[model samples]
Structures are given as structure tokens and as C-alpha cells.
Target: MLAELIRRDVDDIVDEWEQFARSSIPAAEDLSPEDLRDHARLLLLAVAADLETVQGEAEQHEKSRGELPDNSPQITATAHEHAQHRFEQRFTLDQMLSEVRALRASVLRRWVEQNDRYDPDAVAELIRYGEAMDQALTESVAFFGAKVDQSRGLLLGVLGHDIRTPLGAVRMSAQLLERTKGLDERQSKAVQRILSSSDSMRSMVDELLDFTQTSLGMRLPISRVPSDLGSVCAEVLAELEALHPERDISLACEGDLSGQWDAGRVGQMLSNLVSNAIQHGNELPVTVTARAGAGDVSIAVHNKGRPVRPQSLATLFEPLAQAKDMGGDRHSGSSGLGLGLYIARQIAVAHGGSLEVVSSEQDGTTFTARLRR
Candidate 1:
């Protein structure tokens, strides 16, 4: 009965809904009347048609849970298209939801006005109508959120990539300055500072690129080739030593550390692990060890310092966990996006490996990464 009522007064209902949308949303000021009315009418017709379909108790439950397949393709398509249009017009999520609320209210008010009093059948039809409208709303919200995420991911990816070119030039120039003849101690120190800052910027930009790629449903890219884990670990340790001349760190390797893996990515993972250790290890010695198993190799970086909080252990490898978990003194002198450990774990997973950590007062903290050959 409600479905027939909607069909009979669809035009009037759509006109009122469009007017409400135009008034509530500033973005709608630029939209033509026809554009605002088109999807609302189609969505209303789809909901009315769906209300006429017979459904059992089980189906009703599934519909209420939104587990049922959208039986009306038009409802889904129209909602998706409407959401896209709103997103392109720079409409906020709240504004889009307000339009749905306005449409539902207009239809319900018309139906109630036509019916003199409440009846059992009318109440049941109203519930079914609400479920239909809810489904449409869910679809629209999902589409709009996805579009926002995709756009943000793309913007970060492009910005990060474009920044690398200029950043690389600055780093190279600083390196050249460090080698320039007849430079005083202060001048040399300034150049070294520039080089160090550039390295930090490069690391941040790399993390941003990697984070965007993974957030946008893309896997961390890796190129597997014949490599030596021992060599990679030694190279990473050497670089860390150059960067932190004040710190004491050492590396040890046992068994054959040869494997089929992405050498550069593995080096990056080790670098992140060791850097994390040096930063939080309270000026104590940091140890790096590598050992080969039957078909895999494990690399561990151990640090002697205050133990990581028990509650923070679970999220240690999560992006931005550093900012959330590490505060005050622990976060001092640390300038990163907190993506280092997260990206390290992703690299391990991409190489068909795993990464884990253990921390305690007596034993300190150790992060171990195992990679399959």
C-alpha cells in the first residue's frame, strides 16, 4: 500500500526532496534542478518496487542486516552515481546524508497524510520502506568514503614522488660541499648537518610513498633475486655507523646467509629495525645477528634499554603507533612518520616471511625478522 502511494505521488515527493537538498547543501546551489531531481526519483521508484516484492521472515532478517544481495540493481547504481556526483561537486558526507533523510521524511509525511489512521499493514510497509532507504544510504556512504580515500592516497603518492627529485639534488649538493677544499670546521659541520637533514627527509618521503601504495590496495613492490643476507646486513650496519658515529653497534653472522630475496628491501627492513633499536635503547650497545635455518634465515636486532610497555607491544608495528605509544622522553629526538616498523613488517610479509618482537626489563627488546629462501 505504501509502495502504491509512493508511485502515485513520486513527482511531488521528488520536488520537495530536491528543494530540501538545495537548501541544506551549499554545493547544490550550482547544480541544476534536473540534476538534483534525477537520482532521487529513480531511487524512490526502486524502493517502491522493492517494497512490493514478497519476502519471508528469514529474508526480512537478512535485509535488515544488509546481508541480502541487493535485489534491485537500479537502487545500487543510482545511489553509487549520486554519491559520485556529490563527491565531484565537493559535497560533505553530512550533506549527502541529509539529502537521504529529507527524501525519506518527505515520502513518509505524504503517506501518513493520505492515510487517516495507523493500521497494521501500513506500519509493516513503513518498516520495509525504511529498510530500503537504509540500504540506499549505506551504498552512497560507502562509495563516497572510498572516493575520498582513493583521492587522498593518489595525492600523497604524487606529492611524495615529485618531492624526491629536488630532495636528491639537495643531498647531493651537501655531499659535494663536504668534500670541498679549504673549508673551515664550522663550514664542514654545517654541510654535514645539511646532509643529515636531507637523509631524514628522504626517509620520510619514502615512507609516505610506501604508505600510500599499500593503503590504496597495492602490495609493496619487490623484486626477488639471488642475494646474500649477511652482505645486506653488513652493508646496512656500515651505513648506520656512518650516520651515528656516536653510537656503538655491532653485527654478527653465522651459517650460510644466502637466499633468493629482494636484497634492497631486506636491507631497508634491517635498517629500520636497527634504527628503532638505537633510538630507544638508552645509549646502550645495539647488537645485530643473522642465522640461517634449513629453508629460511632470521635476523634479530637487540637493544639493552627500558622495556617496551606490555600494552604497547601489540601495536608496535602499526603505522603511527610510535606517536600513539611512545611519548615524552622516548619520543624525544625522533622525527619520523612512525611508518618504519610497519613498512618493515610489510616487506617481510611480501617476501613470504614474518617479523616479531620481544621486550622485557632483564632481556631488553629484540625484533626478529625471518625470511624464506
Candidate 2:
């Protein structure tokens, strides 16, 4: 009975929905009837299937909010396809919402007109219809938002990569200016400032690139070769100390430090963790320790400072989860985008390794990366 009703009313529901779609979404104005009605038939059929399903009130409550993740992939997949098409067709969230609202109202209007008078069970059917609609709408919204985020991430990745060529040229010109003849002391300081600012810009660009690549379902690229992990950490530390000589950073390497891993990526991760330590730690010396045992290598960056709150430990590795004011260490190269630890963790994941952290008042905080050698 439910399926028959949907089969009877699907065209009307779609026509009414398309009118709302066209008015609300400029892109939908150009969509053909096939495109505008994309998946509407399947969506209505899925709702009809749900109405026929024998589900308890408890299950209904859970499913209404799209909480029954294991119930029906067919239904969810249909909704996801609908959302993907809408996203590709450039329908905004608002327009999509409007279309769904119009669909429900149209279906209700048809149901009312069909019986000529309201059935006593109309309220019960209405509740089940709303639940099914909610599930489909939730699935659609989730898919739509994911597609939108991926597009944004891809755009940022391309933008960040393109910005680097010009930035490198600027850095090269700044270096040449530093070596210019007949430069006064004031002129030299100005050149130094320009160099510093350019380096900061370069770091920001690199972070943005890393963030976007990871967000867009791509890993940061790395080239693996025989490299000494100890030397890599030392080289990274030397560069960091030059930028932050006032702070104390020491490296301790033990056992075999040579490995077949991406030296540049390792250095990048080490640099990020150490920089994070310096920024969040107190005026104490930050320590980086690398050790190789058997077929495993571990690197730990340690600092004695305030402990990361327990609540924050869960989300600390998430991109941009840290506060801006908590960062901004002059040499940290973090414009408070909070991507350092996130990028570092991703580098470890790409290397088939893992990044872990332990923080406490007594022991301070430590970020450790374990890699298989």
C-alpha cells in the first residue's frame, strides 16, 4: 500500500520539489528534468520500503536521526547518490533543504487528497514518514557536506602549491639583497627582516599545502633513501636553534640511527614536534630523543611545562585544534593554524608508523613517533 502510494505520487512530489529547487538554486535552473529529478524515484521508493519495514519504536527513534548505521545500505546508498548528484549540480545546502521540505509537503498533500478524509492512522503514518525522511535527509546532508569539504581541500592544495614558486623567487631575491655591496647597517637589518618575513611566508605556504593534501585524501609525498635519523634530527635542530638560539634544544641518539626512510619528511616531522614543544613548553630545555632497537625506531620530543588537559588530549592531533594565542612562538612557524602536529602525525601514518602523545603534570608532555625499520 505504501509503495503504491509513493508510485502514484512520486512525479507530483518531484515536480513540486523542482520548482523550489529552481527558485532557490541558480544552478538548478539549467538542470534538465532528468537531472532535477535525479534519484527522486529511488528516494521515494526507499521511504516506502522503510514504511513497510517492521521496526520497533526504539529502532524507529534511532533510525529517524540516521543512527541505525547497519540497517540498510541500499536506502543509505540511494540517499547518498542523490546528495552526490545535488552537490555536483551545485545545489547549496539551503536549496537542498528547501527541496526536501517541498517533497514532504507535496507527499502529505497527496496523501490527504487521496483518502478524501483523514484516516485515524494518519498520524502514525505521518510519524513513520517523517522518521524515514529524516534518515534520508541526514544521509544526504552528510554526503553533501563531505563532497563540499573535499572540493575546498583540493582547491587549497592547488592554491598552496602554486604559491610556492613565487615565494621561492622572493626568498632568493631577499638573499641576494642581503649580499648586496655598499649596504649600510640599517639597510642590512631591513634586508634581514625581509628575509625573516619571507621565510615565515614560506612556512605558512608549506603548512597549507600539507594540510590540504592530507584533507583531500592524499598523503604528503616523501622519497625514501638510506639516511641517518640522528643526523636528520641534528640538522633540523641546528636550523631551529639558529632561528631560536635563546632557547635550549638538545638531541640524544642511541643504537642504530641509520634507516631507509624519507629524510626530508622525518626532518619535517621532527621540526614540527620540536617547534610545538618550544611553543607550548615553559622556558625549559626541550629534548628530542631518537632510538633504534631491533627493527623499530622511536623518536620522542619532550618538554617540561604545563600538561595538556585530559579533555584536549583526544583532539590535540586534529588539524587547527589548538588556540592561536597558545601558539605564535616567534620561531614556531605556526601562524596558529595548528597543523604542525597534525602534519607530523600524518607523516608517521604514511610511513606505516604511529604518533602517540603522553601528557601529565608530573612528567610533562611527550609526542612519540614509532616507525618500523
Candidate 3:
């Protein structure tokens, strides 16, 4: 049978597999032979054993769908282990997959050479072997992708933290320069630019840190104290007005705006919404409204401009979703890594609230955050 043949020639197949993997992948160049051959023998034996299992028509269908019982634990465990080791070795995902591909080719070539007679059993065995390889590849790829995401989150966390110290120093220096006496007009303008640029960089760093926290499956931390929604909206609007002097931004508040909430996070959410409106609102006036419902508080930022595309509405708040400048008077300084809305939504969610948007050509676009008190 094919299983016995695999068991007998596994070593020979692995030798060819190792050679091909080493030659094809640059990262494998520095790895020792033992590392290169890691888990190969076990993977091959697991596949051979899986081929020998008695799978009925139903099980075969489930296997094809990747929903069948894991007949061999070794395949799954070895795939994860191998992928983890390769990731630590600095091998790229493609490079690691190339090794798997080489092993598949080596084994298939040897099997084909031995089985010149094309019969039904031979065809079925070949199909099963391909399925096994595919299963292993899927496991390894998933594990590798998870590792990559974790590393990226860690790097972003470190970068965001490390950059803040220098950014703070620059901002402090600019503030000191602004207070200096007898400054010329050009010098004053330059200092203002420095402070503005520093604020922008600080905003981006905060967004990156928030993105890292959310992507790592952690909710945004909030400290709820006795805070007024009206005060929060006013403070955020004042800051935004200073940053965007040319934009006409107004705030309207009514009905008990006092609540127990994180005022700072709410301000952050409002700032993101207002900035997005100003950038995409086609140089139009933006309005902020806060209303107190029976048990909830709703804050909406409205702007008149081109409506967001219907398709994009679903993913508008997803991190890194391309905020395409869709032929409008988008602010020149509005470019970002597309994490503003995502972080805003996360903040709202953390406060046991939700953020939503409604856009239409005639009615304009409005983003609303409803927080439960």
C-alpha cells in the first residue's frame, strides 16, 4: 500500500525535501541540518498514518471540508511547533511555506516514480496525500499568522511608548519658545508650526497605541468619574477649533448632560468624529449636538458633504480601512493611518455604548455615539 511505501522511503524523501527547502529559502541558509529537518519525519509519518485510516464517505466529505476529527494529533502539533520555530528563526511566511511545498513535491515525485500503473486506488491515495499536505499547510499558516500579529502588536506598543517621551520634549520646547519675549513674526509662525506638528505626531502615537491594545484583544481602559457631557463636548470643540481655525464648528447641548463616564475618552471620541467631519465635509460647517435620553446620552457630529459609499459604511470603523479621499475638499492635513474611527468606536464600546453613522446626499453625514448611564 501507499502508506507502507511512504513509511519505507520517508528518509529518502526527507533528504530531498531538506535539500530543496534549503536551496529555495534564503533564511534556511543559516539553519543547521537538524533545524532544517525539524518535524519533517514526524509530519511524514503522520500523513502516512492518516492515509491508512478507514474514512467512510461521510468522513471523507468532512475531511474535504476540513471539519473532520483530527485523526492524527501529531500533524497539528508538529505544524504549530515547526511554524513557531521558523518564526523565531526570522523566516518569512512565504519562506516557511516553501519548505512545506518542497516536502510535498519530493514525496509526490517519489510516489509517482514507484507507481507507474494508474489505477483507482492509486488515484485515491494521491488525493488523500494531497489533502493531508493541504491540512498541514493550513495549520502552519494559521499559526504563523498569529505569531506575526502578536509580534506586530508588541512592536507597536514599544514604539508608541518610546516615541512619546521625545514627542513630549519637543512639544515642551515649542511651548517655551512660544512664551519667549520679542519674537519676530516669522519666528512666532515657526514656533506655532512646531507645536502644531508635535500635537499631530502625539495624536498619531496615541492612535497607534490604542490600535495595538485593541488588536491584542484587550478592551480600552476607562476611568469613569462624575463628568458632564456638555463640558466634554465644549472642551473637545475648543481644542479642535484651535487646530482647525478656518472650519466653522459649533456645539449645542441640552437636557441633563451630567453623567458618570470617562470624560477624557469621550473627548477623544468627539475629536476624532469632528476631525473626520471637517476633513470630509467639503469645507462646510460642522455641528455637534448632545442630548440626554431617558437612560442614555447621545452625541452626534453632523457635517454637510459627500455621503460615504454604502459599501464602505460596513467597514468604516475597522482599523486600517482605507479612508479614501473620494473627490472632495479633504483637508491637506487630514491624512492618517485610518485608526481614528476605529479607536473612537473602541472607546465608545468600552464605555458600554456604541457608535454609528448615517450618511445620505441630501441629509448629510452624521456620526452618533450613544452612552448608557
| Top lDDT model | 3
lDDT of 2 at 248: 97
Which regions of candidate 1 deviate over 4 angstroms?
304-314, 321-323, 327-335, 360-362
In model 3, how large is the Cα lDDT of residue 357? 94
Over 1-373, each residue of candidate 3 has an lDDT whose tens digit, in order, gives 7788889998888888888877788888888988888588888898998999887888777888899647557788889999999999999999888888888888887887888698998888888988888889999999999999999999999999999999999999999999999999999999999988887788888889999999999999999999999999998999889878998999999899888899999999999899889888888999999999998899999999899989888889989874574446545344456888999999999989999999998999999999987
Model 2 spans with C-alpha error above 4 angstroms? 1-3, 22-42, 45-78, 112-128, 323-332
Task: Tell me the lDDT of model 2 at 45.
Answer: 78
What would the per-residue lDDT of candidate 1 be over residues 339-360, giving only the tens digit for each residue?
8898999999998899999988
The Cα error of candidate 2 at residue 114, in Å, is: 5.3
RMSD per candidate (Å) reads: 2.3, 3.2, 1.6
- Where is the poorest 10-residue window by lDDT in model 2? 323-332
Cα lDDT over the full model 3: 0.88
- How accurate locally is residue 338 in candidate 3, as Cα lDDT from 0 to 100? 80
Clashes of 2: 0
lDDT of each: 0.87, 0.83, 0.88
Q: Alpha-carbon error at 269 in model 3, in Å?
A: 0.3
